[model samples]
Target chain A: MAEAAESPGDPVTASSRPLFAGLSDISISQDIPVEGEITIPMRSRIREFDSSTLNESVQNTVMRDLKAVGKKFMHVLYPRKSNTLLRDWDLWGPLILCVTLALMLQRGSVDSEKDGGPQFAEVFVIVWFGAVTITLNSKLLGGNISFFQSLCVLGYCILPLTVAMLVCRLVLLAEPGPINFMVRLFVVIVMFAWSIVASTAFLADSQPPNRKALAVYPVFLFYFVISWMILTFTP
Target chain B: MAAVDDLQFEEFGDVAASLAANPDATMVSIEDPGETPKHQPGPPRGSGREEDDELLGNDDSDKTELLAGQKKSSPFWTFEYYQTFFDVDTYQVFDRIKGSLLPIPGKNFVRLYVRSNPDLYGPFWICATLVFAIAISGNLSNFLIHLGQKTYHYVPEFRKVSIAATVIYAYAWLVPLALWGFLMWRNSKVMNIVSYSFLEIVCVYGYSLFIYIPTAILWIIPQKAVRWILVMIALGVSGSVLAMTFWPAVREDNRRVALATIVTIVLLHMLLSVGCLAYFFDAPEMDHLPTTTVAPNQTAKSS
Candidate 1:
């Protein structure tokens, strides 16, 4: 971004030399009042950073968003506590987990199709409604966390259990027996507990110690339900 | 920060005693603790704020209170009007929830904890938490019971959300409305009956249900004996709170009326738990070989 900002004129010159060159040297107007709101077009308003983001192709934008989503998922998988983790909140990670889980557990879609697992619509509704309920509980309990911030945290924390489900499917590929069942049980239990720890690590400081359980109980149930689903998956 | 004691918990104690003295500060003066037994049961914090103001002499707290006073004085339709309903501190909420959990006789739950400042924060939230708790646990128990059945299909029960919303909202809201109306009518007929404001009634009902938030989640246990036992324990604890709190309000009336009112409270309490248990949590259909085969899986986790 610093390079892009510094080399702003380079992009124009590389594409095609400006006819007069000085026309490109013109700066944005500073005479406009800076203190108040104005209805500037979005392109003009963000013209300064245009070279970095605006000139990117569709694939580049998607990749950037995906990279952000991947970083959050990685944080959940590793289960670290950092203030910067709380600063950025997005639903993309949760949405990806829901899709991934639904695809992995595709024994049957919700009576809709034969080939697909649980439909995306079903997973989407369950995840969002659970997240909304959990967020509402935290806010009502007088936690200082914002709604979507908690939602995104809870959503990303599902990463471990989703990963457990993936591992369970691979274990199921082996012959069904006592050994496989024990392996599945062990993986599901560990990841289920990990999911809880990751979520509360992110959310714990926001709630008071006494009332933290009230906010966290809903989070527990959210992952508990998914854990049960994973634990019960059959070959 | 603690100029005297190094103990950090002294702060919670200091704040707790001062908590009861806060809402009606003007009414409770130096001599007031000798008069009102209910508000002064704890060590007198009547002059604690004065000491703090003298030592810290921070106008920041005063400025915030002044801003709050301005907010309370505003008309009802503005944004602060609604926000102020949920403006209670975390300590006060915890104290109220504690009082609801441990219903000590001779001290009214509403009067000791709620009547002074009765906000809608607890009532609104406890109800919301119970809604999701039941919905999620209900679905989970269904899956867990059928865990090892090879042919059994898993479908997420989306309908439980709506059903939970309806049942929980109706009980939390409609019952309070009816009970408040009954109290109002009885107050007019009987001379000087203790009449609870509608919001206070709603707040008590709301906090009383906090036990069920944990209980509902535990209902995911597939064993019938454990589920019923949990329901009964939750019912007994929260039920005592409501019954004892309301006992004073109806003790003056005739025995039949009081008995009937108490019965209705107990009966409705039973109906909510048992009805929800029956409706949401299904009994195990069959205990077969597959379940036996996977029984060790459950045992393995426990071990």
Candidate 2:
């Protein structure tokens, strides 16, 4: 019976039998020998810097990389499990989001002390610090993802929050009243929760099951503090 | 060699097919069946090897499950099919009133208590009683004014006063109901704060009117200065109660939202008090009273 189960042309019976039911549907059966050396194709590797590669024009290389970064940004916004886009770490999205958020925060308070506005350096430092802190926590908790990849995910996750901040800035344009307060409150709350969920989805893989909840708490607190700041931002 | 290759391929296919049939089967374990045990024979350590293997081996299934779970849990505000807005014991109303009158932290007890035991019964009755009291007092003051003038004012219009009082009182409740609706809509979006239900809003607004009852009673006091002093005192008391009750819920995270809520509550309270004072207490000037003789023999005298 076992020998019949192993027969090449008897796949239907083999698949129907419990003994051969452990296989993934995607894997195809083909007769192949295991004695000889088997070669597995490697995924495309990121090119390393070399003198030969340096011969390529800087502008052309930068343009090509930028295109790749744009694709990665789109992937982050509408994530696809099939794509390994997070592997292509890029700083452009993070940088843009950080600056935009800071500007949105500062726009409402333009009339205050001219220097009181959120300085770009200050905003960048805060964003960097938060990302690094979360990355370090994740790493210490058994996250095996690369530091840059985690940072990229963390940064991209701020997109919803950035949109929230923009909404708050617009809300400030309305007369400060109960209705206005309600709108601002609603935006911040939703964005804050979104940020936490999005970050956890990308970064919580390395955490043990027992520690996952504990690890997610800091991410929740981080987004909450940001949300609070955005909600309270009055021009 | 080719025949051996074909045989090996068939074995591989059999394993794959078996895996497809029973995805949870232990046959997928990467531990080599023929190899001797290594290390402590415990769960895999975080040396990155196991994770990499898992990622490479089961990327599709893992991601599909994760995405499915995420999509399933993403809807934050599910429709509440049945909601009980009012549910509080009669005795708790006194507790709520006492709590509302306490200091900032003490007021949080009222908020927490109200949150747990929300009800409109106490607040509704309290507001209704105050409105009725105000209407009755306004009629009493009009009767006194007529006696002082030695001419009975055209049988004091109880209907007009009652209608006005009812409209104003209804507004006192309506505004809060509207505010509750707005808060509910807002809560649906962000869902950070535990939202107070419609009944809770009414209860808070009702308890806040505890001070207004005294102001309504004092309306019959003929002295304008004394009435104004009493009105101010009433405002102070009710405003403090509102601040105490609402502060804890609003203060911690969003200062702007807190400010807006406080302003709305205070404004609504003041509008009710002012409307009561203006409509019920501010009797029409004697000069505007069209002098007419009820009796042909009686002479109309100017005061």
Candidate 3:
């Protein structure tokens, strides 16, 4: 059966069309009635075709091919959705609360007056686990969590971090002073790297965490420079 | 309108096909018998030359008229600027929200961050966590100053310096925000939303400035009643905007992430503040600065 053809001036909605049609042919010709008719001479595309030879007749076969090719290209660009899961927050949230409570308890016992060592190692480990496990896994875990959910997952990680903090405190207690400061800095830097890794691997679908960090450092340096200048010049 | 230019689209398929071959094709539609029928073009029968000309003229005028109408609505002064700047995925989201419709992501919220666009959610989460971390740090510094003065020896100069440091830290936190906004603006790339990352930065910082700063400053108010009033207003405004944006697609892990970020920042800030205080107390005093002669018990504490 032959397809229906539109008359000289009828309008059609292209969006109503589907993704597959063997061949679509359209032409606009003005019937002058008395004088010779004028053919607008437009083009037609073969959206899909069972016969390869018919596809060659498409007005802009390359464009249609490119679009089809582009659509095909997009599918292969990212990882399969099933591998990355959305995590369960109910289990994760309370776990973090527990860890935070433990840390507060430990900090309560330590005297704030003395030079106690930093519990940086514990903080680092906690953050590492938190980022890797919950923050990273939520999407993979098959759940729709909010930004707050991300926070809760990280919070659970913080408990273990507090434990790490306790350990750092012990180390600081042994060594004391600027050495502890150095240790803390080292831990923060490590945690920062872990955050970057988590961002790239799991947060891959999300924004890049490290980009802001990079932007942040420069801004801080700029402020520091301005402040230092003011401090130096001011009477 | 129908009498005029109905003939123009008569060759839309052919034009689309031609354009498709050009490799710059934007959109195309296919007619499939397998799928349900939609907008089926009625049989084209009656019409004349003068009517055809009028239709063609109408289409031309209509195109120009549409463009003119669009230009009139294009000014950035409206709420659309906010929507364009803040809404991440769908402009339709902005329109719906603007229209005061409740936004609930019936089912799309189940997808993981990696599945949607790849790597987009990760950065946003990181940025959000970092923001929370900075806030906690400021809070921690405040707590330490309180603890140091209450529990141990109080040095006026040290207290002043701690205050100064806290102020600096608070301001420093805004840097990431500024950068975030700048990048979002520069990229003009929207991960899931219509607006880019820049919009997020603007939303975060704009809301922070309008919400957090005033709330923090109000704490200095002499009367609790007045302070609470200001706090309520700030919370209501900020909270509503956040809820409107967040609740539509709440992630289970987000709350945990936020908490962890808060705790880590608070603890780290505390450690730094105390460390700085300890350092200041122990360092030898120069002639220019006032010296506090340490008693034996105090000396032990300082050591």
Candidate 4:
């Protein structure tokens, strides 16, 4: 009787079949040994699956490659995936409202004049502050964070920023010459680069330094440039 | 040839596909300590090569939840994740500039110098000399001519010339903006630092001009408040200049950072404008002041 179709006595191999063959449907049993997690899902559901119908070897290769890519990109921006106060909305909302209010007050000052108003130093401060305030709001919105939490994040991130500014000021003071401008430029550049990397690091460590979040001088520069160009050139 | 065919790595295959993609890679025995994790090998039961290969290679196409069967998580910013959110070329130019600025030996020298002194002077001196030379060469003649003119309060001839020059200077500034933008696009990623740096310098230098300009000219309201307001505006602009020019680490674009900047600038401008109005125009003084305030009842109320 055709040798009983080669049926074996092995308990787990009653009707032995290759794990994968010409079958149209595939069920993947993924068990991460290191993590001790077992996940069984359809092969077609996997975003990284090679194709609608792929062989075992091909599937293995795709998963490995995907893991590597995800790890690299993920680490590039936030190494630790930690939370911070900068994600708080309560703190930012009022802070933003205050800034807006301040600007409105200034606008009133301008309206007092028919030909235009006098220049005020505090106006520029408000401008710089605007950049920081807006950025905080944007992060909170994107991060789905509480307004108050974002304020805390800002508090932490601003530390490195303050230091960089102080250092730049000190450098400029020592020179007070034409070269001072160059030094100032250099300081700003260095501070920006440092902040980007530092923030990324801070994001990784759950206990990010509140003092560091204040290092936003670089973002100011970006706004200053873009806005200045638009204001000056758009006409 | 047979080996390549036998190792027929389906384009969208597993980790093995990664290995297959790199034909030059020497395949070590799977038993090698480094080749495989130290954990016990999985049961050699199923023909999983194809299944695993498909999983690994099809990552991009796989819209499946990173958490199996779970909903995908959204990131902090939706716009930031958009494919074209960043202009890549602009960043590349920025990178190129950074690369040129940081040569190995030169970088080492600067680092060591800074480390020893913690404040750079040698480079500052060199840069100063160049700036001084340029400034003097470009403006000395104008300086002398201005000094020669006895009617300094408001020379009609000079004012006309200056108005024309102001227009030209404004035009000249555009060149830097465009060139910088182009450069940024070339190395869009690097644009992060270069663009910010350029903007900072402009803020600083632009405000510095006020130091030389007559404060009285800014008097649009009453005299007392107008001057004070002007001074404040100048200072605020100067601060922005200083912050932008001096701080390099401020290049990132987080949501909070962007918002802070916008609010700060708008408020600053508003404050300055208000002060100017309060100081420059003496509408209330019309009835009180014998010389000005043509309108009636204005001065009595202001006093």
Highest TM-score: which candidate?
Answer: 1
Which ranges in model 3 have alpha carbons more than 4 Å from their true place? Answer: A1-87, A109-152, A156-160, A206-235, B1-85, B88-303
Angstrom error at residue A115, model 2: 69
What lDDT does candidate 4 reach at residue A171? 67
Provide the lDDT at A12 for model 4. Answer: 39
Candidate 4 docks at the CAPRI level of: incorrect
Better of 2 and 4 by TM-score: 2
TM-score of chain B of 1: 0.70
Arrange candidates by TM-score, descending: 1, 2, 3, 4
Question: In model 2 chain B, where is the ten-residue run with the lowest total lDDT?
Answer: B33-42
Query: Using lDDT as the measure, which candidate wins?
Result: 1
TM-scores, one per candidate: 0.63, 0.36, 0.26, 0.22
- Give the alpha carbon lDDT tens digit for every residue of B4-123 in model 1: 212322333355345533654322222222233222212224343333343232222322221123223336876445544554555567878998888887667766666334667688
Model 3 DockQ, alpha carbons vs. true complex: 0.01
Best by DockQ: 1
lDDT of 4 by residue, B123-219 (tens): 1111222222222222322222233233321111111222323332452245335434543554454434323223323322333333313332334
lDDT of 1 at A26: 24
State the iRMSD of every prediction, in order shown: 6.1, 23.9, 13.6, 15.1
In candidate 1, which residue pairs get closer than 3 Å at backbone N, Cα or C atoms, i.e. clash? Answer: A106-A117
TM-score of chain B of each: 0.70, 0.59, 0.26, 0.22
